[model samples]
Target: MDAVIIQILNGLDKGGAYALIALGLTLIFGTLGVVNFAHGALFMLGAFVAVSVNGLLSLESVTLDPTKLTPWGTPAEIRTKLAEEWFGTFGTTLIDYSVPVSIVVAIPVMLLIGLIMERGLIQFFYKRPHADQILVTFGLAIVLQEIVKAIFGANSISQSAPASLAGTIDVISGVAYPTWRMVYFFFSLTVIGAVIAFLQFTTFGMVVRAGMADRETVGLLGINIERRFTIVFGLAAIIAGMAGAMYTPILSPDYHLGMDFLVLSFVVVVVGGMGSIPGAVAAGFILGILQSFAAMEAVKQYFPGIDQIIIYLVAIVILLVRPRGLMGRKGVMET
Candidate 1:
């Protein structure tokens, strides 16, 4: 029972990332009718944003300390973070919470990137074939990955949660959970809810949702549906970026981090149904939990590496059973 609880929590934690990424993917697909292969790269870029901010905060100011002499040197050099030197205790605390604080930087950066991507590249592919869109976007993803590798190198960069949230939390009598994981899970849920509410309740969301249903009709009504869709694309990028930024502490990020989640996110989108937000979220959590269970020693003892293949296996089986997807509309991919 305790083990089951543990796996469930782990699954939710993992699922939060999957759902967030897939949500953004679905939004782009639904709004602009574009399959964005570069979405994962956006996620990677978000993580790097956190990395960049942390790096900036930790910039060292070195000064010679005559009071502390080295064994063979005239004096020792004292190095301190510029943030610490500038703000003292407040700066130290800010640096300590850099990972979380990075969101502020990430939002604007991602929004700008998304806007440039849509206005510059993706807008041209709107009327192109899906294959072309996929090829171009995949190429873009590779290009982005290589650019990051060149800038940050091809190694995993470690990020730590704040000291206060680094410890384990006692959830149940026998089951303990990581504090950061819980924070991440709740944070993800809140973001998801906020997005849903924005789409469902607001006037702009209504127009966007209507455009998703029928862009031609919405445009015929003089709504400037294309511009709204562009905004949607940017919004989607922000969601993906924010997810990646928050996830750095959970998974040390590397250049290939985006690619690592790309396939799974696609699988989640397909299983949830192309353009189906709720479906994407639901499938993400389901697959995440199933994958978690498959990783158990008892299960793997019989199946052998089921954890790695469970998601794909499930995808195959589900597609066979339901061609469109679990919640896909009748004509989504039929054309």
Candidate 2:
């Protein structure tokens, strides 16, 4: 029972990320009918945003302290962060909370990137083949990855949550889990709920949904469907960036972080069904849990490498059974 609970929690932790990324992918596919292989790069960029903010907050000013002598009797150099030097405790607070604070920095940056990518590049491929879209976006993803490697170097950048969230808490009398992970899970839920509410409740969301159903009809109704779709693309990028930013504490980000999640996110999207938000969310949690359970010692003993191939295996079976997906509507990817 304890093992089951632990695995379930672990699954949720992993599912949060999967669901978030898959949601954005679904959004782009549903709205633009473009297969964005570069979506993962948006996630990587968000992590870098956290890294950049941390670096900014930790910018150091150095001075020679005549009063403080070194062991060899030479004057010692004092180095202090600019934030600490200028704002004292306030600067310290900023540094401590840099990870969460980066969310603010990532939003506009990601939105702009998304908008630029959609308008400047992706728009050209709207009438092109899916293979062409995939090739271009995949090339873009590689370009983004290389750019990050050049700037930040091919190394992982570490980030941490606020000190208050750095420890573990007991969910039950005998079950303790990392506080940051719990926070991340809840934060993901809030963001997901917010996105869903926006889509399901707002007039804009209704219009977007209608456009998704029949874009030509919506355009004929005097709605600027193209503009709305572009905005939706930007919104999708924001979601991916936010996910990447919040995920830094859990995984130190590398230049290839985007690619690492890209394939899996695609698998999630396929299993969820193309252009289905609810399906994406549901498949994310299901696959996450299945992957978690497959990692168990008992399961591993019976089936070696199950952990690695669990998601793919499930995808194959699901696709075989339900050609669309768990909740997929027909004619989505019909050729």
Candidate 3:
């Protein structure tokens, strides 16, 4: 039915986000062999970057004159009257232009942050034990969240899509679908495609893949495997951050969004398997669609608390049956 189709579309977008985050997680786990618990924080940082970009763009000055004449050389009195009626110096002057411009600004800023975190923090833990690595990255995640809070304040930052994307579109004769949500879906798909292409065809990706297979031999051959791992971590952070940035319109940026996403992302990664890109992508969509099915108004009425249990229930069943996950490698977690 129309309702079912609609929910499936809705779930795809959420799945796209999950796929993106999980893909990054799988890449790091497969290549660097490090269980990064800080990935959620990176996602949080991305959303904050969008917020920061929006805030920065708000600093622009319109430089309007209350008494200035118009293109038709309208009377100063009329112009002044209009300005007095509709304008204020204290409030936002560029509210219309801020969101679109913020997206452009958030990317580079977040990429730089990603590089810094990888080079400075995550790199050190690459050689450490899983427990130490987990603690360090978890601590780093906390630190990152605190830093975001300190800068953006403890409260969530308000942001939404541009005016052009604020409303809904009529997909059929009777239904009007939300434009921002559609845009989010498209944006996430674009990112996921680019990432998949990078992993599938790029030389750098090939090298990383090589390293993932046998890092010891790759290092013995004189390649800087550690440096590649650092880059991988940074790349992972950038992916999470971009996802966060684009998600601002869907969910406002909060200090805890990182942790929020981190948990679901981990589930996504695990359900996909330890290091399978296809698995991550597939599981993300599967879980997303399943979530949608569970949230159905009719289904919820019958299942009672279906939304709360659907994901966990599905995960448990998958792990019980697949053990290593749908596409998981036999030796992945065992070693």
Candidate 4:
């Protein structure tokens, strides 16, 4: 029973990430009818933002003390974090909480990037062929990946959770889980709920949804639907960015990190049904749980390497069984 609970928690942790990414993907698809192959790059960029913030916070200033001599050395050198020196305890706290702090920086940075990408490039492809959209966005993703590789190098950079969240908490009598993972799960839920509520309750979100349902009619009604859709793209980017930033401690990020998650997220989107927000979230958690169970030693003994292929297998079965997915509209993805 404890083992089952542990696996369920593991599934939720993984599912949160999958759901967040898939939700963003669904938003872009549903709002703009554009296949954003570069979505994953946005995620990678968010992780790098955390890395950059941490690096900035930890920047050290070196000084030579002429009055003090090291053994066999002419002078003693001292180094101190510039942030700590400037802001003292507050700066120290910022550095310690760099990953979480990066979310603040990432929000504006990612929003700007998303807005620029949509206005400068993506808007042109709005009526283009899906193949063209895929090719162009994929190319953009590669360009971003190469640029990051050039700057941060090809090595994976590790991120640490805040000192306060670095340990495990007991969930039940025998099940213990990482505090950070639990935080991430709840964070994901909060973000998800916020997005849903915003769309369901706000006038702006209502206009966006109306535009999504019938863009031409909405525009005919004198609404600037295109501008609202552009904002939706930015919102999607923010969601993806937050997911990546929060996931840094669990997965050390590299240039290829986005590509790694990109494929699986695409699978999640497909399994959830194209442009279906609820379906995406549901599929994410379902697939995550299945993958976790498949990774168990006992399961592996019966079905070697099941964990690696489990998601794909489930995706295949789901697609075959329900062509439009669990909650997808009947006509979506239909030939």
- What is residue 92's positional error in candidate 4, in angstroms? 0.9
Ranking by lDDT: 1, 2, 4, 3
Assess every candidate by TM-score.
0.99, 0.98, 0.86, 0.98
lDDT (Cα, tens digit) per residue for candidate 1, span 262-328: 9999999999898889999999889888889999998999999899899999999888898778788
Candidate 4's displacement at residue 316, Å, is 0.9
* Overall local distance difference test of candidate 3: 0.79
Separate clash counts for every candidate: 0, 0, 0, 0
| Candidate 2 error regions (>4 Å) | none
What does candidate 2's lDDT look like per residue over 124-178, in tens digits? Answer: 9999999999999999999999999999999898898999999999987789899
Better of 1 and 4 by lDDT: 1
The local distance difference test score of model 2 is 0.92
User: RMSD in angstroms, all models?
Assistant: 0.8, 0.9, 5.8, 1.0
Instruction: Report how far residue 70 has shifted in candidate 2, in Å.
Output: 1.4
Worst lDDT 10-window in candidate 1 = 325-334
